[model samples]
Target: MNMREKTTKAENTPADKVEIAVRLDSELLEQIQHLTNDPSKVIEVAIRQWLRGEILRDDELTRTPVRTPVPPRGEWND
Candidate 1:
């Protein structure tokens, strides 16, 4: 309806959001920005890594291994 509302909305709107909050130290935040050139990009990269790890972990859990259990030594009937 007004310029102020439009400006506020534009600034507040996130491209995508997860309803969560995370806190980081100022030094850490600065470090991430320095390393990635964008703080948000660092967060995005971290989220991607975390998701990938979950996928790998799930895959390992669901994969079937072909291995027979070994019994005690010298227990075979001649």
Candidate 2:
């Protein structure tokens, strides 16, 4: 199997966590490298904050109605 196939198979594994690749700008990566040795943790935390609506773009902050929040899994009784 080639590299792509290997990556796809690994990503599909039934595990609590799976590895995936992301591309980042070289300058941004360098900045992250300077801040922490565990960049993955930083990225994960940023994603979680975004999901919780703690982070938003300037345009999004001014948008009408705003985005509706998703209810937690157990609350979807309808």
Q: Which ten-residue region of model 1 has the weakest summed lDDT?
A: 4-13
- What CA RMSD would you report for each candidate? 7.2, 16.1
State which candidate has the highest TM-score.
2
Q: What TM-score does model 2 achieve against the real structure?
A: 0.51
Cα lDDT tens digits for candidate 2, 1-78: 776655665576669766779999999888988989978778888899999989868887787985889998888976
Model 1 C-alpha RMSD vs. true structure (Å) is: 7.2
- Report the lDDT of model 1 for residue 31: 87
Best by lDDT: 2
User: How high is the lDDT of residue 47 in model 1?
Assistant: 82
TM-score (all chains, Cα) for each model = 0.43, 0.51
